[model samples]
Target: LEVRQCLNHMTDIFDLIDAGVSPGRFDLAREKLKKKFGEDAAILRMLEGDARWIELWIAVANTVKHPKKTERIVVNDLRLLPDRRIQLPTWQLFHSTRCLDAPQALLESADIVIQNLLGLFENLFVVVIDQVLPALPSGLQWVLDDIPEAERDPKCPQRYLLSIGMRNARHA
Candidate 1:
């Protein structure tokens, strides 16, 4: 598709998502989108690549796992969409995970966290679908599903970002 068409398509999808549609329905819509725009991951990674969703995912996960260490890690500095400082959590997470100073490495670690979270999300949905969906009031599912996190898809957009652009760009 042309750039304009791509933009238009993305615009429409965001519009639906902003309308608070169910994730199942949104996931279905994305499938339909992929049929035309190639695989979902390609487009998803493009939109998601380098987005603030990474830091947010890291923030939420770190917060939940280590609430007592909240003061040590603050996610307030990353107003940028594609936050490069994903390693902030490792330092603040209260775990002995090796420091990830390289921004690209930090981004990849963030993706790992996101992938783990997605597993949690799918499992949570499976359990909730039968028990809660039937019992909850109308329109509650879509509004509560939380797509703010959906912006991150278990993979970094720029996992191989040239954090240290080479002195030997092409020495071979």
Candidate 2:
């Protein structure tokens, strides 16, 4: 459920960026983006590249909706530790395991999935911003100028901050 919610949140961000191109529903907006930007568009490419992550997210979401389907999905992606904690393939959630006990592993797994999805969203936002910024009105060009030199890169944390700020400003 939380994983699905996170994906929805990221989609909302994409919908916002796509509003100028297609003002209606998010599905239509995404289609418009694909039509306008072509198959090689950064957003489309990023999403296509994250197929495995999306599959896992969907499987988990389905399991949440239908508990009986849980067995079909690999809910044990993380290994439980002897200390009543859980560890991902690469990292261990020491504090979370200690605090939440048995459920902490599942929570941490959801978090990892959410973070991966957010990373894709961040990359897509950078691409969309790069494509849109230059076409903005001269007065609005100040927005990009206001971004710090370090945050200029799309992958930088500051870039995501700037993107969200711009998104909020547009909505307001």
Candidate 3:
């Protein structure tokens, strides 16, 4: 659920940039991104590539929020471990216990989805910042300085910083 929220927040920031608003609370960033960039955009393409996991996460979040209207898609069964303590399989995002003929593959798939989502966010943020930077006021430009070192990649120092600073301020 937290992961989903993080993704949604990132989407919102992307939308805020697209709209050229001063980065306040706004709604429907994900929808805005899709509408503005279209499905063919690279960032959108990356997200579509992991659509299965995103769909499952949405279903799981809905089930959690409105259990009466949605069914839980993931479950774990407890088992006795060799150490005499009980253990449970990783929580999975599908209704079944197994996927692709393997037990607990759903968790792995979900992890991949999360990783993809993070990458997509990074890519989308870069794209949006590039589009919006020219129009931003000079005083507001200092916000770029807050970008973390990791994202300030030497190969693309100017491109990767915008998203990281905005993310740190919001998520910190």
Q: After best superposition, candidate 3 residue 171: deviation in angstroms?
A: 30
- Summarize candidate 2's per-residue lDDT along 80-110 as a digit string, tens digits: 8899886664322212112212433456665
Strongest candidate by lDDT = 2
Local distance difference test, candidate 2: 0.54
lDDT of 3 by residue, 1-172 (tens): 7656765565565544554222321234434557887767765565556556555555566566756422444556777879998664655433332222234544565677666666656666665656666554433332443456667667654433332333225433
Minimum summed lDDT over a 10-residue window in model 2 is located at 92-101
Please give the ranking of all candidate structures by lDDT, highest first, separated by commas. 2, 3, 1
Candidates in order have lDDT scores of 0.37, 0.54, 0.53
Per-residue error for 134 in candidate 1, Å, reads: 3.9
Model 2, residue 106: C-alpha shift (Å): 5.0
Note each model's CA RMSD in angstroms: 20.1, 10.0, 9.2
| Candidate 3 Cα outliers beyond 4 Å, as residue runs | 17-39, 81-88, 92-114, 135-172
Q: On a 0 to 1 TM-score scale, where does candidate 1 land against the true structure?
A: 0.23
Candidate 1 positional error at 3, Å? 31
For candidate 1, write residues 55-111 as lDDT tens digits.
344444455556554223333333334665333322223323322332333455556
Reference-based lDDT, residue 112, model 1: 67
